[model samples]
Target: MRSNCLPFRADSAAATAEFVRPQRYALRASHSIARCSGLIAAVMLAGCMSAPPSIDAPTTRASTAAIDLPLADPSAGVDMSLPAQRPESLPSNSALARDFMELSFSLESGRAIPQFSRFEGPITVSLGAGAPASAPRELARLVSRLRGEAGVPISVGASAQNHIQIDFVPRKQMSREVPNAACFVVPNVSGWDDYRAARRTARGDWTQVKQRVSATVFIPAEATPQEVRDCLHEETSQALGPLNDLYRLPNSVWNDDNFHTVLTRYDMIQLRATYAAELHSGMSAPEVQAKLPAVFARLNPAGGAVRGLRDDPTPRAYVSAVNRAIGPGNTGARRAAAMSAINLAAAQGWNDTRAAFGWFALGRLSVQNDPETALNAFAKAGNIYRATPGAGIQSAHVDMQLAAFALSAGRAQDAIALVNRAMTPALSGENAALMATLYFIRAEAYDTLGNPAQAQQARVDSAQWARYGFGSDAAVRARAAEVAALARAGRG
Candidate 1:
C-alpha cells in the first residue's frame, strides 16, 4: 500500500486545506478474475480549494472561515481561462516502465490481471441520454486531446456501435449506489442499468475480459464542468487503457493523489505505448513489460535510461492510519490516527514523498486543535518536499495552507513569501484552483501591506482562473470572502 494513494477523497494528500471524506474506490472481485477497475475517485476542491489530494480526500484544515465579503459589481461576470500549453518533462524511462507495468497489469487495490488487453481497432465513444448539457462540449475537448496527445484513435458521439458508453447520471443516485466512488468504469457494461446488475460479478470485471469490446463510465450529470472533466479524464483513460491506479506515480492522473485532474503528458505517453502497432490485445503482462522499453525508446527517445526518483512501498499500517486520520471519525480518534501515520513514516526510515504526506496529514489534523503542531507538520512536510525532486507542486499545496495561516495571523509579508515561492509550480502544474487560491492569498497580503494597487491587481489576476477552478461566480466569490475573512480573524 502506498500512503500517497489516498482512495477516493479525504486527507490533504493532494494539498486541500480541509480534510474531506475519501471517495471510495469502486471494485469488482472474485476468487478468479483478471482485474478490478481503477479504484480512485476524481475529486474536486471547487475553485480555490487545492488539496494535496493523495485522493478524493477532503482532509483537515487548521482554520476554516466563512465570512462574506463586500458585494462586487454585477457587471463583472465570472472569468475563466484555459491553461497555457507547456512542454512535457519526461521522468526516467525506468520509472515510466515501472509505472506502465503496475498501471497496466493491476488495479489500485493491487489486484492483478494475467494478461494485457486493449481495443484492437479504432475506439468510438457515445454520450448517454442522461448526460449533462456540457457532455458534448467536454467530450469533444477530451477527444481532441486524446487524438493530439495520446495518438489514440478515438472519436466522440458515434451514432452506431459505440465501444465506450459514457453515462451522466444524477450525482445523488450515483453517490448513493457507489457511496465511496465519485464515478467509476466497468467492463462489459454499456449503461447504468447494465452496471447495476453485474457490478459485483465477473461480468463487470476487467480481468474477466480477454479483448475489450465495450465498457461504461458513469459520471455525475449535474456536477460542475470541471468536475465532469475530471471524472471523464480519469475513467475514460481507464476504460481505454490501464485499469489500475498507482500511488507512486508522481505525474500521471493514474495515481490516487488526485492532485492531477487531467490527462497529462506522461499519461499520453503511456497511452501511446499501449496502442503501439507492435503490441496487440491479449498479450500477457510479461510480454507487455518486455516490449515497453523499446516502445518508450521510440516514443520518448530523450528520456534516457536514467534512474528515476527512488520510490518506497507504503506500508498497510501507515496507509490505514492516514486514512483513519483523514477519513470520518471522532476528533480524538482522528488525531491519534494522524499521529500513528506520522510515527509509521518515521519508523520506516523512509525519505520519499510518502513520508512527507504523513507529516502533512498530521499538520492538517492539528490546525484546529493544536496550531503549533500543525505549523510544525506543514514546515516539515514543506522541507521534505523541497528536497524531493518532482514535488514542487505537492509542496505548493502545503504552502497554500501555511499562507492562509500567515494571513490569519496578520503576517502579510510571510503570506506573500509563501505564495510567491509556490506560484511557479502552481502555474507549471496547470492547477487553476491552487493558482487562484495563491492569488487570493497574495491579494490579502498586499492589502495588509497597504499596497492597494497590488491587491487589486492580484484580485484581477485571480478572476479568470477562479472561474475555471471554482466553477461558478458564486464559488469564486465564496473563496474570495473566505480569504478576506482570514485577515479579519487576525485583526479580531
Candidate 2:
C-alpha cells in the first residue's frame, strides 16, 4: 500500500522508451539483444515475423518524382559502437529493482535453475504482540538483502490480521515452491489478529502458506516470457548479498514440474520448427508429422492432447477455423498459457524473450496460417490493446509486428504500407528513433519485393533513423553489415 508501489497501466507505458532513474546507482549488469537466425530462431526470439508468406505485387506509390530527395551514404553517419555507461546505484529501494530484473530473464530462457542455483532463503523472524518497533526496519533490510542475494524481490504485504507477510514475488504465472511451514517458520507476530488465525491454519500446509503472499510481481500479461525472465534475474541479483553465489544451491527446493509446465509450449514450438526444418531440407511433411507427435506427447500427459501442436488433426481444422472467423480468429490459449510460465522461470533470474515471442508466433501461426488472416490478426491485436487501458499491450508495436507478418507472408506491399502509415507524427514519435525502425521495416519489405535500389535507399534512411534513436554514430554504423547482406541477397 506504499505510495511509491504504483500500479502499472499497460496502455500508457511507452514501448520504445526506457525509464531512467533520477539518481544513479553504482551497479554493473550485462545484457544482449538476441538476433533472429531463421524461422525457428525467429519463433524463439522476440520481434520476429509470425510465419512465411508469398511475396505479392507492388501497390502503386503516390509518386516517385514527388518523393525525390538526396539519399545519404549509409556509411557517412553510422554508429557501430557499444558504449559502457555506468549503472545507476540505489539507496533505499535499489535491492527490489535489481533482483526483479535478473530472475525475470533467467525464467524466460529455460535456465532458471542454473541462474538461481545458489540462493538461500532468508531466516524469517516473527514478533509477538507489542514487539520492538524495529521489526519493520529489520523486515525491510531482510527484504532488501534477499532481493540483493537472490537477484529477486520479496513482496511485503499485510497479514490477514495486520501482521506483516513476506514472500518472493513470482517471476512468472507458474513457479515451484518449498513447504513453507518447515522451511522458514516464523513465530507469533504482534498486532495482527487476522494474520495469526491464518498462520494457525497454515502452520503445516505448504499450499496455504504460499497463499499468504500476494502475486505482486510487476510483469504485465502482454510481456513476452523473455522480458519477464530478464527483469526477474536483474532484480533478483540486485537484491542478493554483497558477495555473489553463482553455484551450489538447494535440491529439495527445486520443482521440475513447475519448470516443465512453463516451458512446455516453447518446447513444442521449437519441435515444430525442427520438424519444419527437416521437411524443408528433404523429409516429407507426413514423415515430419509422424515423428513430431512424439515430441508433443512428451509435453502433454500420458493420454492428453499434444501441448503445442496448432494444426488440427488435419490441415482442414485450421482452414475451417480461419474461414469461420474473419474478425480475430481463435484465441491461442495454450500458447498464451505457456508464455505465462516465464513468470516462474524468471523468479530464478534468467531472461529469454526470444523463447516467449516464439511461442506467441506459433499461436499466431495456428490461427492465421495465411498472409491476409495474419495481417488481420496483428491489426486485431492492435485494436484489442487500444480498446483496453491496462491490458498490458502497446498498439504502436502492432505496426512493427504486422510488418513482420507481412514479410513472412510475402505481402511486401502490405508491410511497406503499414510501416509508412505508422510512421506519421500523429501516430508515433516519428523522430529519428522511430523513423530508423520504420526504415528498417520498410527496407526488409522492399528487399522481399526484389527492389534493390529502393531497398538501398531504405537502408540509408534506416541508418539516419538509428542515429536519431540511439544518439550514437557507432550504433548506426554497425547496421551496415546487415544492409549489405540484404543488398547482396536482393541482388541475387
Candidate 3:
C-alpha cells in the first residue's frame, strides 16, 4: 500500500491482509493486520537499485558501483533478500488492454485521472534527510531494474530538474499526515514540508498532473530495512507509472488483491509499455487505450496468443467489504465484513483469485474466534489457489494457516506435510517472514515427532531468516518465542 497521496495498498496470500490505507495510503509489508505464530501476514508490496539516469540499464548489475562497493558498506550486513525472477504466463492483449485502461483512468478511490502522465526525460532519484543506511543499496538495485526491465530512463539522485525525491519520515509523523499510510509517492512535492502544505490541495493530487515534472516518495524512517525496501518498490513504481491499483489483477504490484513485493514480470511489461514510444504524457484515456493493442502486440507479443477471461469489474461494495474485513474494526464487525465480502464475491460469480482472496481473508479473520469456520475457509481458499495459475505462493499461505491448526490439534505429521508443501514456494517468493514462520512451524512439528536433530536444524534456519524477515537479533528472538509458545500450547 502507498499513502502520501493515495489509498493504502491491500494484500492477498501476502490481497494477501489489511485493505486500503485511509486517505493517501501506505503499503504494508504484509496484508494480514495481525500475524500470530502461523499466519504469514500476506502483504509486502512489490519490490528495488541505483543506476545513472539513462534509458539503457544493465542486464544483471543494478548499480555501476554496486559490485565495487567496499567491504565496509553497511548494506553488506543487511540480511535482505530477493527472489529469483521466474517467467510469467502472459495475459492476452485483450486482457492487458482492459487492465491498462482501468489502471490509467482512475485511482483506487474511483476518482478519475483526467490525463496520462510520465516524465518526458531521464528521471533522477535522491535519498532525502533521515534515510536509513539500507536505502541506497536498495534504491540502486531498483533503478537497475527500472531501466533494464521496465525500460525507464532512470538514474541515481541528481540536483537537476528531472528528479524524484524519497524521504524517510518517522512513522509517527507520517501516520498523522498520511494516516495508515505505510509509505507513498506524490507528484509535485519534493519533501515532507512540501507534502504537508500541498497534501490537502490540488498540488498533491496525481490526477491533476499531466506531465510529471518531479515527485517525492515518503517512507517510514523507523521501519525495518525490509519494510523500508518494500515501500520503495511500491511507492517508486507508482511515481514512475500507473497510479491506480486494481483488485482483478492476479499478478503485478499494481493490484492490491495480492502483491508481488518485488515487481513481477507482469509489472515490468506494464512499465515497459508505459514508457514505450507510442505513448506520451497528456494522452487522453481513449488515446492510450487505442494505442495499447499495438503496444502489447509489440512489447508482449505472447499476450497476443488468445483472448483472456477478462473478468467483470469488481464492485465498490466488495472492495469495501474486504477492506473492512482486513482493516481496523471490532472482531464481530471484521467477521461480518469478511462474510459480506465472501457473499459478494460469490454473487459476482468469481471463480478466480479474487474469490480465493475473500476466502483467505475469512479464514484469517476467523482463526482466532471460529476455528471450524476458519479451517473450512482455508480449505476452500486452498482449493481455488491450487487450481489457479501462478498462485503457488497463495496456496502456500493457506497451507501455513492450516498447519497451525493441525499442530494445535496434535497432528504433527499433518503439520509437517503442510509445511513441506509451502517451504519451496515461500523460498522462491523470497518472503523471509513467511519462510521464517514456516521454519518455526517445521521445527515445532519435528520436535513433536521426537526428531531433535531435524528440529534443531529447522530452528537454526528459522533464526537465520528471521533476522532478514523480522529484523534485528532481538526481534528474531521475540518472534521465535511467540512461535515456541504456540507449539507449547499445542497438544503434541
* Tens digits of per-residue lDDT for model 3, 1-492: 543221111112232132221111111211222233232221111111110011111122211111221222223334434355556576677877778778877888888998998889889998998888778888998899999988999999775666899898877888787564667788888788888889778899888898988988888777655566667888888898888887667666666654355677777888888899999999998788778878888987776642443547889998888777766557688888888988988898888888887887777666554555666777888888778776767777777776666555555676677777777666655566677677777777778888988877777666545545555554454445444544554542
Q: Candidate 1's error at 109, in angstroms?
A: 1.6
TM-score of each: 0.79, 0.28, 0.83
Candidate 2 residue-wise lDDT, 1-492, digit = tens: 001110010011132222111111001000011111133112211221111112221222212311232333422332322235332222111222222223222322123222111112222223333322333343454355444432332344443432222322232321122211111222222323333354546443222221122211222222222222222322222222111111111110111111110111222233223322222222333444444445334422233443333321112222222222211233454334333432332343422221222222333443323333333434444444444322121333445455444444444565576565555421222233334555665676676677868876776555444533333343333333332233232333
User: Which residues of candidate 3, in runs, are more than 4 Å off?
Assistant: 3-86, 305-311
- Which one wins on lDDT? 3
Tens digit per residue, CA lDDT, model 1, 63-175 = 22222323333223223333564575777787777777777777766567878888878889988886665567778888998999889999975634338888888767776
TM-score of 2: 0.28
* Highest TM-score against the true fold, candidate: 3
Provide the clash count, candidate 2: 85
Candidates' lDDT values, in order? 0.65, 0.31, 0.66
lDDT-better candidate, 1 vs 2: 1
lDDT of 3 at 381: 83
